[model samples]
Every structure is written in C-alpha cells, then in structure tokens.
Target chain A: MIQDIMTVAETAKLIEAGNVLLLAGDEAVLRQLPKGNWIGGTIPYFISHAEGGLATRDRIFVTDVTGVAQSVEIVERDANGLAKVYAEGPQEGFSVVIIPALSKAHLSFALNAPNYKDFGVRPLIGWISGVHLDDLGKVTPKVFNGVTGNALEEGAVVLQATLKPGKVAEVGIVNLFEQGGGDILTFPADGFSAKEVLVNGEKRNFAAYIVKNKLDTRLPLVADYYGALVNISFQGIDEVEGEVKFYAPVFTGIRYKHAKPVADYGEAFKACLENKCQLSEDRVVFSCNCILNYLYSGLEGKKTDPFVGPITFGEIAYQLLNQTLVYLEVHDV
Target chain B: MDVPSMSRPQWTDLVTGKKTYQLKFLAAKILLGRLVHSVKENPTPANIKSCIEQVYNVYAKNAGSPSVQEDLTTIFG
Candidate 1:
C-alpha cells in the first residue's frame, strides 16, 4: 500500500478507485495525477511504512483514506475559506490540510494561528509542502487539490472526512524534548524577534547568549504556560543583528516559567518513540514529522516505530509545531 | 562488505558510484557522530548491536550501498 516514485499510470489507478489520498511528490509528477479526491504538497522526503525513510523526486507518497470523505474544500485568504471551516467543520473526522511552504498564506497562517485556536476550529492535522532539496531555490513549493489539479502556493487544500458511523478521530503530538532545566531565558517584548533577552535577569543579546554558552539549538525553548508544555523552536540566529528568530513567536506577556534544554536528542527521541509507539501503531492513520527533527536527529533512514509520513518544513496538529511528530488516530466511539 | 571499516573515500565511492553524493554524505556524518558517541559510551553486547542497527538505519537505509546493506543483515542476523 506504501509506494515511492509511483508512475503516472499507477497513480491513475488510485484516482479511478475514488479513494481520498494525501500525496507527496514533484510538481510534474503531481500534475500528471488525474483529478480526484485528494490533497497533496511538494516534497521528496518521506517516512514510509517500510521501517525507514526515503527521498525521491521520481516517486510520490500516497496514503488512501479508510473512509469516504463527507466533504472537501480548498481554503484561501482570497475566498475567506478558513472562516467557513471554523464555523462549519464536521464534529466527527479531522480536517486534513496540506499547505505549500514559505508562501504568503503559510506566513499568514502561522502568525494568525493563535487566533484560530481561540475560535474552536475542528481538529486540524497537516504539513507545509516543500520543494525538493535540489529545487529549493529554483522552484516554489506547491499544493494540489486533485479535484482542481493545481492550486496557488498561498492557499491550503483541506479535506473534511466524515469518519464512518461510530468512528472517531483524535489528534495528538509526540515530542521527545523535555526541559533540561538550564537558564531562564525570556524575551522582553512579545513578537517573533528577540534581539535582546533576559538571561536569568541579566540582559544579553539572544544570539550571543546562545553561541557563548554553546546551547543546543535543536532542542528548542520549552515554556510551561499554565501546565501546557509549549515548545518555541529556534529558526535561526542573525549574526549581524545578534537576534534570535523562532518558528513560533514568543509572547512577552506570558512569563516563561522555566527554560528547558534537550538533554540528549538521540536518546530522548528513541526513548519517546519506544514509550509511545507500543499502542499507537494500529490506531494512527496518518502522521508527519518536522524537518527540524529530521535534520537534527539524523532520521533519514531511522524508523520512528509507528509514526511515518512526510518530513515537512513545519507540522500542524492544531497550530504550527517544531521538532515534533503530529498524528491523527481513529477508533470506534 | 566491510562498510564500517572502509576509508571515507572508499565508502563514498562505493555508495555514490561515479556521481557525487555530497549532500547525502554530509547528512551521514552528522548521524555517524551520534552513533560513534553512543557506541563509545555503552559498548555492551546488546548496546553495540542496537547502535549498529540504528547507524545503518539512519545512514545506509536508502544509500544505494549494496555492500553496506549486506553487511548490516549479516552482522545483525
């Protein structure tokens, strides 16, 4: 059922079967697929069901839906589609979203994501599609709604699947990184950029503090906000400005209760999978991991037990996440 | 089939063939560092076995390195 680099002829068969699919492949290959009930994005990296990973431009990653989708729609800022989903999303199955990477919509969604959290939207699970490593700069990332063939980069293709009667879908994340209790680092102001921060009450340049202390950028900064563990992942360090950029903006208003460093990435990752995957294998329907984890933990070929899918630029469970595995599991209610 | 023991250039040649596999090799080195560190710390019979399996999993799974794959099967089995 799991295949890499599928031929157009083979893909045509899946389309004919009327199955709902989530696809990952090159733009040309994806373009060749017959329009049908599917949503896809561009990416060559995949965590397949075959106990390892694969990166291929010739093939596509396809996962067929177990149940027929009740409804499907493409949401775009131009169409006010996200608002519609927020108001009318199904109460049963989760909404599957595939967003193109680094597009205007992607940035808009990431920044305004907290607003969606407040609106009580349906369970959302998805990833940002990306260009192949070789095509990173040459081509823009694209998402596809098989019903529409190709979609604008700045839009999200969503499928609202209605789980079979009596079936229920649950979304969750498996994060291996826990606070290693290092220094207490906090930004003085709310927003994504923290040029200077309070390192245990001492003002210091964020980038300088990281390099001087040799802090592990891979682990991310963990904040305990009202008992909920929210991880603010490191995006990059601006050397000239001495500013630290984050995947998700850190709010100054919310006190960072503590700062956690990843103890040991490889061991922590392995242990987390070992502990969580024992029961999730049979229930998990679809899953995707953050590319940060893929690069930092060296997971190119490593098996993450029951979790597998695309290694995306970013992962969305309800909101954007970094260095974590997000999955949707279904069971009969 | 002696992948772990092979010299860097030899291994790269075997894995990459005539083409350059620079990006793939760069990714491998990062994982290899962790594997080496883990093996050094434990070195237990069980630990060594698991670490070797993981190293192969992370570095050589889709590496197109037939000898390395063969070696992995032989060593683990």
Candidate 2:
C-alpha cells in the first residue's frame, strides 16, 4: 500500500507525469453577477428559508444569497442544447482560481492543462478546481497586480480580465459537499512509518491548481502556494532601496486545514484571529523565496507593510483580512 | 551529511542571511507539515507517500538529521 504523500520533488514529478491535474472547467460567458462555482451535479440547490449566518443546509437563493453568484445557468450548451452543468459566471464577475487580470499565461495553461496530448514528452500539469463555496462567501478578495509605470505602492491596483471558457466552470460540475472543496497538490513528506505507512491518509497528494494556462498575458500571478498573496505584495516595485518585508500573523501550514478551508478565506481569517492558528515549531522547511523574490525584483512598488523588525498593528489587521499569516513570531530585524 | 562535497560558499549561503531561501524553504516545509499533520487523520496512502517523498527528497538533497534520514529511506528506498 502507499503510505506517505509524495515530496515536492516527487509531487513535481507526478505533476509533470500528469497522473493528476488541478480540476478545471470549460469556458462560458458571464452576466455581471458575483458568481460562485457549484459542485457539478450531486448536490441539489434549494432555497434557504431563513437568513443570517449560513447554516449547513441553507442555499443562497442564487442572487440575494450570501454565496458567490453562480447562476445554475452557469454552463455551456452543446449544439443539441444540452448544458454541461459546470459552474459558470456572467461576463462581468470573476473567480480567484481562474482570474485573467492576474495572468493570461496562467489561464491559458489552465485551458490546455492536463492536455495529455504529448504523452511521450513530459507529463502535463493538470488542474482541478472544485472550489464552489467561498469562505467569506460574499466578499471575494480582488486580485491585484502591480500597475505598470507606477511606484510599487502607488500602482497597487486590483485587476480585472477578459475571460473565456476556462475562466468559468459549468454550474453543476461536481458536488462541493461530497467533493469537500479546497485545492491541494500532494507531495512527499516523512509522515509515514514502516508498519502502517501505506494507508496514511494525510499523506495523500492534495495540491492547489493555480496554473490555468496562467501566463499567456501580462498578468503577474505565479504558480506557487502564496498565490494572490505574493502577487499583491509584489504589485509595484522598481529595484530596491532599504528592504522589502511583510510582517503578518502566519499560521503553521501544519494545522491550516483545522482553521478553515482555503475556499473560504473569511472563516480562515476568523480562525486565525481567534488564535486558532499556531506557529510551527518543528519540521524541515523550504521557502519558495526564489519564486517570491523573482516576483519582487520585477514589481513596481514595495508592498511591505512595515519592516520595523516586528509586525505592526496594521500589518496584523491586514493579515487578518487575508488570513495568510498565522503566527505572530517577529524575526529579529 | 549523506550526499557529498560542498564548497565554502555553500556554508556562507546557509548561515549568513536572516531570510535566505534555504531557511525559508525549511520554514515552509515545517509549516506545511504542522498544518497538514494536524488535520490528516489517515492522510491517504497517496498523501502519505507524497509527504514521505517530499521529506526524503529534501533530506537527501539537503541532508538534515539521522532519524528523519532513516525514516525517509524506509519509505522511499
């Protein structure tokens, strides 16, 4: 039996091999509503009789509901008039998973993702996004790339894109409840032992799929974990003077799931604020700093909140909104 | 370390900076582990294998401790 999850290197290989791909959707048009993707079809939509905080069984009545506005009409039609049932949105709305304003290369990559066309070359990276329910459900964080020709701070602009099929999912692709949302890219780790290692559930290969043909355009998105977080930070920059640093409440990735699902950024933010997140005290680590710094070197402004050696109150509050930082450990700066 | 030969520049890179890619990578891995372990009850065999592979590949390449080294080999080797 298989026990441990694949390491990043191994995960990289699997991703390369195309055994799995980040789940994704075909293209569809939008109608200007804040939309949410729904599971393909298993879960049925019903009217939420009461209003307030969302209950387990409540359905956001399409328009007035608190969830992302995913019209069941979010789908594609065959020449025969049969709808594909994947979550789709009107032209004006957007999704964090497949946003175009950030990176066209990212979106294009997503379009042909897992394009197992060339089986003999390198396995293609596949993406699967079943993230239908937004954690905040209402307020979707806008994806901001650094505005060009402006200082990093000045051009910290939230962006929007011209989207296509890959940008939208058919209304009823998969059941979010049965699917249990959140993107995961599984990799190798030392979480397994000799005896019962093969069945280590936690070690399974779960990864986020952010590579939706993501680079065809000039968007600044990247294919790493800190996805939008890093993009926002590196929004505007033009070299360096002092130093760039971001101090925020960072949670241990070890217990991040316990806090909140990535699909729901608000509750995760809530969990971090409630002190439910923790700082990781152990384990070997790696920083995709190369990836991050690469972005910073190209940005127009310094997005660092304050490098006063420790996190500032404002920084903490900002992190509270993004929920990216979990622990408040201040590095000796 | 299990691997082999390193120059002086390697040592400087490892300890000279407060936020070297090396340190951050380790920090990220640890963070990922802590976060994942806390919730992975029976992280699937595939998940376990993936985790083990990540741990060992990094260890083999980076060369950390004896216990972790031993554990990694048992799973991947």
User: Whole-model Cα lDDT per candidate?
Assistant: 0.64, 0.21
Chain B, candidate 2: TM?
0.37
lDDT string for model 1 (A1-333, tens) is 333336567777888887778787888788888888888888888877574666777777777664535555544342235544433556655687777877766776665654442232355688888877778779989888788676667778777786666665556677776666678776778666789888888889989988988877776787643223556788789888898888766765343423355455557767777774444466777888887777777777787756778888888776666677887766654
Error (Å) of candidate 2 at residue A130 is 26
Clashing pairs in 1: A5-A59, A5-A60
Q: Is the docking of candidate 2 incorrect, acceptable, medium or high quality?
A: incorrect
Question: Which residue segments of model 2 deviate by more than 4 Å?
Answer: A1-101, A104-333, B3-31, B34-39, B43-47, B62-77
Q: Report the number of clashing residue pairs per model.
A: 2, 128
The TM-score obtained for chain B of candidate 1 when compared with the true chain B: 0.45
- Per-residue lDDT, model 1, residue A263, is 55
